[model samples]
Structures are given as C-alpha cells and as structure tokens.
Target: MHITMHDIYKSFGTNRVLTGVNFDLQEGEIHALMGENGAGKSTLMNILIGLHQRDQGTIMIDDKETYFESPKEAEQRGIAFIHQELNVWSDMTVLDNLFIGKERTSNFGLLNMKEMKALATEQFRKLSVSIPLNQEAGKCSVGEKQMIEIAKALMTDAKVIVMDEPTAALTEREIRKLFEVIASLKKDGVSIVYISHRMEEIFEICDRITVMRDGKTVDTKAIPETNFDDVVKKMVGREITDRYPERTSNLGEIVLEVKNTSKKGQFKDVSFSLRAGEILGFSGLMGSGRTEIMRTVFGIDSLDKGEIWVHGKKVSIRNPEDAVKAGIGFVTEDRKDEGLVLDFSIRDNMVLTNLHSFAPKGLIKDKKEQEFVDVLIKRLQIKTQSSATLVRSLSGGNQQKVVIAKWIGIGLSVLILDEPTRGVDVGAKREIYQLMNELTERGVAIIMVSSELPEVLGMSDRILVVHEGHISGELSKQEATQENIMTLATGGQ
Candidate 1:
C-alpha cells in the first residue's frame, strides 16, 4: 500500500495547527515523521485516520484519492496506528484489551476466550513480551503497556503501521526485540510510519525522514542523505550545540530520606537520600520498581514497611495530600492517568497543586492566578493559545510541561520526576534541563527517574542503579557510564 497527503491544513478555533503540509508513505519501507511537539505531525496523521477532518488536503492511496470516514474504515483498509499514549483499558484483562472491539466468537456467537488467549499469546511471543494474558491491563508497567500496544497493532494484519514514540518506555532488551520484529514486518512487505524524537533510533530504523516545523513541512530526505544535525535543524529550526545543559548546583544537607522502604510485590528494602541542590538520578530498566518506589514515596501506593523523613523530621504520609503537606511533589510517569485532568483548562490544571497558596480563605485571586500561569507558560515555552485552553488539546510535550509546572508551583522541598523527557523534543528538552538547573540553584532537591542513559549521565550529580526492586549499585557522576549502569541494571556484578 502507498499513501500520500498533500497540502494539508488544519485549525482549531483561532489556533492554526497545520498549514500546507505534505507527507507520503511507500510500501515495504520505513518512513519517519520527525518534529517538535505540536508541529502538526499528529494532526496530519489524525486527519488521515479519519479522527479529524482536514480543512484542506488531498489524500491518495495507490494512485487513487481516498479518505477514511473512521478509524475502523482505515483499519479495514490495512492501516494501523500505535499512538504515543498507551490506550490500554485499565479494568479489562490483557486478552480483552488485545481484541477489544473485534473479539473472536464461536459458531453460536458466544465469546471464545481460548481463541483470544491463543492469538494474544502468539502476538506476545512474537514481540518477546512476557505479560500474562489474565492480568489486568492497568497492573502492567509502562513498557509492558507499550509492548501490548505494538502487539495489538501487529494483530490487525496491517500493511502500513504508524507508530508514535513506540519505544519511549521500553528497556534496552525490549527495544532490541521490537527492532527485530519491525525488521521482520518490513521484510514481509509492510510499510511503517515511525514517529519519534530519538534521533539514534530514527537513523537506525527508518529509510526516509520528513521533518515539520511551525505547522509546515520543512523537508524530506533519505536517511542516508540526511544527518542528525540536518534533521534537528529542520525540526526545531535552530542549531542545538549541547544536547544537555551543563549542570552546576552545590549540594546541601539531605532534604528527604527513605530508609528500609518495602512495597509488597514491587520493591524491597529500598533506601535513598536526596539532598538540596542535587539531582539524584535513578537509573534502571522499565518495571524494575523505579516508578513503584517513587509512588510509594509520594504516598500514591503504600509502603509495607519503611520510614520517610523530610527536613530531618519523620512524616507520616498516608495519601498524596499528606505527601504534598509534607513538601513532596511527584510528576507521575503516566501523565494522562495521574498528572492532569484532560477535561480541565491549562490554568485549572496548573493551579491544582498550588490552590491553597492562591485561594486564601476559599477565594481565588484571578489576576494573580493568570499572572502566574502566564509567567510559567512563557518560561517553559508551552505552546498554547490561552490558559483557558483544555489540556487534552495540547501536544504530548506541552502536556508534560503543564504537569511539571503544576508541581513546580507547589514550592515543595523535594520533587520526584519520572521519565521527565520521555516524549519531549531536543529544544524543549534543553529548556527543561535548564529549568532543573535553576530549581536546584534555588535549593530544591530532585529525584529524577529516567530510562535514557544520556540524561542520567548528563544531569545527575549522583546515580543509583535499580535491578529487580533492589538498589544494585550507586555511582557518582564522574564514575558512571552507560556500560556500568547497564551492567548494574541487568543484575550483573
């Protein structure tokens, strides 16, 4: 199958998202869509998949003009999409989520659990995934959920698959497995539309690349013809000399400390100390209890046994509110599920954490709130028409920024960041790193949980490697390297 979109234009109210964009996909090849968040890559795809109508565009498939009325129509035409955000049904079992709308049924029209489980098991095996078919989808880790999404898409018998940030949550081992699966699919004459901000992976897997900027298509080139610098220049329209901003923060006394923390079936005997003006980097594979440990610290999940101390005083945090009162803020890994209310406006989401500070005596000072929101929006470079804009409409990168802004307004003593730059582009990523540097300069301690080795090595003053719920090893910034971190993360000596 071959697909082409030309002269695409889209707008929401007064916000112009995409204008005069051109993209094309060829059979038996991998085409990459590279851009910063809100650059209209997603909008163009959404228009193609019939989720949204294009105000102006021409879509052609196999030399004939074609437009899908719904995603079901596109799926029936052999096109599948694995979105950046995982779409797993939390309450449903893994098998159910795998065949959600199109379940297998017997001759009598009764449900066929055995057939569904067998198909799901085969897909998981192909992806080298080990998740149980009977487990609740929500119980799976982010990486596991990511793999499930990929497997579900593969089960569609799609000739063309559009994958957006598919490996953002995957571990090195799983990433390798996914790459192998992609290779096999390509060999089977499937065309792939790969979207990711990871430059390395794009160059490694894609055959051609298309970059968008400010609602326009900058250029398209073969992967062999374009270098990483060229693609980034087109994506952000600027030369990024440093991938990561230099870190300079003097360490102070420990601000938050956890001792002998244990969460049943998650982590065990975990202990760590976070000091003011220092970035404590948590390095580990996904599902290695890194996120669970932070959830326990933030009181989202209970610690079966542990002691938490803030500012050298013990605090009993029974819930997230209690954790907030104790001066700890958490930027959760799953932003859509835990960080922001999709239905709420950007302003409303920003003030969720600092409501007490803004609303004295149950009265909100609208002027002060607006000013605060405006300042952070400018500081963070969040692309939004107005604070009244709903958060659900913002791009993934901007949504993550809102989550960070909400926690930043709380004036917490300790901040826990999980996968802070998972879907962020190069320019915005530098901006975030600069913000972290400034925050540390202001004496706020941060515990960053990241799967990106370069981020851990670049921004952290100290690093702790986690393997299967244990603190396998700790290393200073000067001593840590990718090899050492991987060795420790994989439970090697």
Candidate 2:
C-alpha cells in the first residue's frame, strides 16, 4: 500500500505548523522520517492518521484519493500508529491490554478471554516475544511493552505502521531485537514509517530518508545516496562542524563526596567523589542501577546507609527541596513525565525551580518573572514565539532545554543529568554539549548518566561503570574504551 501526501498545510490557531509539506512512502519499505523536534514530523503523521485535519493537501493511497474522518477509519484502511509513549493499561493483564477496546464478545455481550489470550499468544510468538499473557502489563519491561505494541499492530492486519521514537528508551540488545522484528515485518510486506533522532539507526534500517525542517519538506534521498553529515546539514540548515565541544582541564577542589552509599535492593556500597569543573560520567546497561544511585544522591530516594559531604561540610539531604537548597540540581531522564509541567507556560517552567527568588514577598512579580524568562530563552536558545506559550506546545528538544534552563536559573554547584539528550536531534545535542562546556568553565561540577557509549566517552573526564547495584570499575578518559566499559558493565574485571 503506497501512500503519498502532497502540498500539505496545517496550523494551530496562529501557529503555522506545516507549510507545503510533501511526503511519500513505498510499500514494503522501511522509510525514515528525519527532522529536529517541532519540524512538523508528528503533525504530518497525525494528519495522515486522521488525528488532525489538513488545511490544504491531497492524500493518495494505492492510486485512490482517500479521506479519513477518524483514527478508526484510518485503521480500517490498514494504518496503525504505535506512539512513542506506549498506550497500555498498567493494571490490566497483557492479554487484556493487547485486545483493549476491540475485545471479542459473545452474543450475550460477555468477553471471550480465552480467545483473547490465545490470539495474544499467537501474535507474541510471531514477533518472537516471550511476555507472559497473564502478567500485568506494567510488570513487563520497556522492551517487552514495545514488542507488545508491534504485535497489537499485527493483530489489526496493519499494512502501514507508524513508529515514533521506538528505541528511545531501549538498550543496545533490545534495539537489536527490535531491528530484527522490523526486518521480519518488512519481509512480510509491511511498510514502516520510522521516526527517530538517532542518525546511526537511520542508516542501518531505513531504505530512504525524508528530512523536514520548520514545517517544510527539506529533502528526500535514498539512504545509500547520502551520508550522516549531509542529512544533519539538511535537518538543521547548518553544518555542525563539531559533534562535541573541546573542554579545557580546570579541575578545582572536591565539591561533592559520597562514602559507602547503599540502598538495600537498588544499589550498594556506591562511593564516588566529584570535583568542580569536571564531568563525571556513569555508564552501564539497563537495570544496572546507575539511575538509582543518582536518584538517591538527589534525595528522590532514601539511602539506607551513606555519608554525603558538600565542600567538606557533611550535609543531610532528606528530600528534593533539601538537595536543591544545598545547591544541587537534577535533570530527570523522563523530562515530560517528571521534569516539566506540561500545562504551564514557558515562563512558568523556566522559573519553576527558582520561584522563591521571584516571589520573595510571597507573591510573584510578573514583570520580574518575564524579564528572567526572556534572558533564559535567549541564553538557552529555546525556539518559541513567546514566553506565554504552553510547554506542551514546544518540541522535545526545546522542552529538554526548558528543563535544563529551570535548573540553571537556580544557582548550582553540582548538576546531574540522566540521558540528557535522549530524544533530541543531532543539532540540539551539539548545543547541549556546548552548554555543558560553558557550565564546567564556571567551575560547576557535572555528573552525567548515559547509555550511549560514544557520548559517555566523548564528554566525560572520568567514567564509572555500574553493574547490578555496584560500581564495578572506574577509568580515566585516557583509559576508557567501549570494550572496557561494556566488560566492566557486564560484571567483568
């Protein structure tokens, strides 16, 4: 089922989202849609799947002009959308979640649970997924849920599947499994619209690439015809000469020290020291307890046993507020779910962490708040029309910037970032790396937890490998290598 969209235009109130966009997908081909966040990639897909109406455009499927009034209508036409945020009922069993809304019923209106479970098992077998049918959906891992989502699409006999950031939260092994499943689906003649910010994956799995920028179609090319540099230049409209900024070694006195930190089942005996103007990276595979250690240090989780000292003064942090007051800032990994208040405006999110500073008299000063937001917007290069725009309206990369900006507003001695560039494009990643360089230059210490090996190696002055709730090994920048990191992360010597 070939799909073609021509001269598509869409707008939200006064915001013109997509302007004269053109896209095409060939049958049985895994075509990639590449762009920076807010480049109208989602909007275009939404319009195609009948989630939004296009102001002007033509949609053709199999040589027939078609118009879908709703997502159900699109689904009936063999279109399925697997959202980045998996849509599943955590309280329901895996079988129930798979057959959700479309459950088979008897003549008396009773659910056919037996049929549903059998069908779900069949689909899982087809996808080579081993999730238990009776288990609660929430109990399954992120990778398992992703496989379930794909199996659900197959149950609908979907010919065209739209996957949004499918591998954002997946580990390297899980990603390889997903790629294998995708290969099988392609062989079965299913077309996939793959959207992701990772350039390496695009070259690996996609047959063709479509680049979008600022609500317009920039270029489309075969994967073999173009290189990563060429695709990045088209996406950001500028040549990113450096993937990571050069850092100067300017180590200062120890800023933070954690001795014998332990969290019963989460992590144990974690000891580390961080110095001013240094980037300390924590590397590990999924479920290696890297995030747990950071959470405990940030006061989000209680440490069973440990001693923490800030600038040689022992401090007790019982909560996030206490940590914040002690001059520590944390940018959480799940930015949308944990970092930002989506309903709030850019100004509100920017000043969320430092509200007390703007409201010393117990009432917010609107003028002072706007001035502060204006400066931050300029400083962080957050692309937005006005400070009044809701945070939900911004793109993923810009939203991440707002999260970082919120922490930056509150003066910090140490900063913690977890998967900081998870869903952002290459261009935004360079900007973030430069921001880190700037922060370290001011003598601020940074602790970063990243699953991406290259990012950890490129940005960290020191790397610590975690494995199953313990620090297995530590390496200097000169000594760290991918093989060594992986070996240590997998409980090697």
Candidate 3:
C-alpha cells in the first residue's frame, strides 16, 4: 500500500496542532516520522488511522482518496496501529488479549480456545517471544507486553503498520529479533511507518525520513542523502551539537544506603549507596530486577529483608508516604500508570507531592499552588497554554518534565529516575539531562535506571549492572564502557 497525506490541517479547541503538513510512504519500504514532542507527529498518524478527524486534508491510499471512519475501519482496509500506550487488558489472559476484538469461533457460537492458542503461539514464535499465552497479561513485564502488542499487529496481516516507540521497553536482544522480523515483513511487500526517537534504529531501518516542527512539515529526504545532524536540525529547528552534556559533579557523603536488600521472587542481596551530588546508574537486561529493586527502595513494594538508612540512620518505610517523608522521590518507569494523574490538571499533578508546602494552615492555598506551578512550567520549559491544561493532553516529554517537577522544592535529597527518557524526543532528552546535572549540582543524589547503554555510560558517575536478580558488577566513572557493562549485565567473567 502506498499512502500519501497532503495539506493536512487539525485542531483541538483553540490549539492548531497540524497546519498544512505533507507526508508519503512507499509500498514495501520503511518510512521514518521524526519530530519533537507536540510537533504533531502522532496527531498526523492518528488522523490517518481514524483515531482523530482532520479539519482538512487529502489522504490517498493506492492512488484512491480514502478516509477511515474508525480504527477498525482502517484495520479492515489492512492498516494497523500499535500505539505507544499499551492496550493490554490486565485481567485477561495473553491469548485473549491477542484476539480481543477479532476472536476465532468454533462455529458453535463459542470461542475456539485451541485454535486461538495455536495462532498466538505461531505469532510469538515469529517474534522469538517466550511468553506463556495462558498467563495473565498484567503479569508480563513491560518488554513482554511490547512483544505481545507487536505480535498482535502481525496477526492482522496488515499491509501498512504504524509502530509508535515500539522498542522503548525492549532490551538489545529483543530489539534484534524485532528488527529481523521487520526485514522479513518488508520482503513480503509490507509497508511500515516507523515512529521512534532512537536515531540509530531510524537510520538503520528506514528508507526515507520526514521531519516536522511546530505543526508544519520542515523537510523530507532519503536516508542515504541525509545525516543525523541535518535531521535533528530539521526536527527542532536548531543545531544540537552535544547529545550528552559533560558532567562536573563531586560525590558527597552517603545520603541513602541499602544493605543486603532482598525481595522474594525478585532481587536478592542488593547493596548500594547513593551519595549527595552524584548520579548512580543501574544497567541491566529485561526482567533483571532493576525496577523491582527501586520499587522496594521507594516503598511501593515490600523488602523481605534489608536495611534502608537515611542520613546514616535506619528508617522504616512501609509505603510511598513514608518514602516521601524521608525525602525520597521516584519517577516510575511506567509513568502513565504510576507517576502522574492523567485526568488532573498540570497544576494538580505538579502539586500532588508538594502538598505539604501549599497546606501549611490545614487548608490548601490556591495562590501558592499557582505560583509554584508557574515557576516549574517556566523552569522546565513545559509547553502548555495554562496550568489548567490536563496532563493527559500534554506531550510525553512535557509529562515527564511534570513528573520531575513534582519532586522539586519538596526538600528532596534523593531522586530515583527509571527510564527517564524512554519516549522523549532528542531535544527534550537534552533538557532532561541538563536538569539532572543541575539537580546534582544542588546536592541532590540521583539513581537512574536505564536500558539505553549510552545514556548510562554518558550520564552516570558510577554504574551497577544487574543479572538474574543479583548485582553482577560495579564500575566507576573512569572504568565504565558499553562493552564491559554489557559483559557484566550478561554475567560474563
């Protein structure tokens, strides 16, 4: 299928999201969509797949003008969208999720369980996924859920597939398998609209690229004719020379320390120390217990046996309230589920953790709350019309900044950031890293858990590798390298 969108225009209330943008995709080719958050990349694709109605545009599929009334309508026409926010029904089994709307029947008005399992199994095998179809979808890790979504899309035999941040939660090995699958699909005459912030993956797989900025088409070029610097400049409308800023922070006395921490069915014998004015990075493969370890430290999960000390004094933390009282803030990996309240306004989400400051008289101060929110919106450069804007409407990058903003001015001494830059654009990522450096300079300790090896190596003053629920190795700033970190994460000698 060859898809072309020309002179597109879309708006939400007073916000003009897309204005006269143009894009095209060739059959059997991978096309990359590049833009900073809120630059209207997702909105354009959503318009194509019938998730949103375009105010004005011309959509031509196979040289015939077509506009789908709904996503199901689009899918029936062989176009499938695998969204960034997962749609797994937590209580349902994996097999059920794979065939939720398009279930196979046994001709007796009942589900054909055997046939469904066989089909799901074959799809998993194609993606090299090892998840059990009988297990509850909620029990799967983020990476496994990502693979499930991919497999579900493939089952449709889609002629055109839109993948949004498909590899954000996947490890290197899983990414390799997914890439191999993409190559096979391409040879079968499948057209893919790949949307990802990973520059390396885009350059490696995509045949052409279209970059957008401020709701307008900046430029389009063939992959062979463009370079990374050129694409970034087009995406952000400026030059970004340094991907990772230089670090100049000095470590101080230990502020948060965990000794022999153990959680049944998760990590065991985890020992670490985070000091003031330092960044400690956690590197590991999928399901390696890095997230679980941090969850326990933040009191979201129980620690079976361990000692958590704050400022050289042992403390008991049974829930998130206690962790907050102890001056620890956590930005969960699954931000949508755990970090912010999506339905609430940006001001409400920002002040959720800092209520103590706004409620000194046993009554919330609206003036104080608005003042604090305004400062953070400016400091973080969060693009929004007003603090009254719902967090759900903000871009992923701005939502992340709101998560980070919640911890600020809360008298926080230690901050735990998990997959901080998972789906943020390159420009927003640089802003986030700059924020981290500024926090450390202000004597706040940061513990970053990342799957991106370059981020771990570039931003960390010290690094720890996890393998099979254990601390496989630890390295200092001078000793860490991508090769050795992978070696330790894979349990090498």
Superposed model 1: Cα runs more than 4 Å off:
none
lDDT for model 3, on a 0 to 1 scale?
A: 0.93
Where does candidate 2 stray beyond 4 Å? Answer: 88-96, 104-109, 112-155
Rank list by lDDT = 3, 1, 2
Per-residue lDDT for 1-493 in model 3, tens only? 9999999999999999999999999999999998998899889999999999999989999999999999999999999998887888889999999999999998798999889999999889888888989999988887888888999999999999999999999998889899999999999999999989999999999999999999999988899999999999989889999999989988899999999999999999999999999999999999899999999999999999999999999999999999999989999888787888999999999999989789998899999899999999999888899999999998877888898899888888999999999888999999999999999999999999999988998899999999999999999989999899989989994
lDDT of each: 0.92, 0.88, 0.93
Model 3: which residue pairs collide?
Answer: none
Candidate 2, 341-455: lDDT as tens digits: 9999998888889999989999999899899899988987788889999998888778999998898857799999998887788888888999998999999999999878889
Query: What's the number of clashes in each of the models?
Result: 0, 0, 0
Give candidate 2's TM-score: 0.93
C-alpha TM-score for every candidate:
0.98, 0.93, 0.99
Pick the winner on lDDT between candidates 2 and 3: 3
Weakest lDDT window of 10 consecutive positions for candidate 3: 395-404
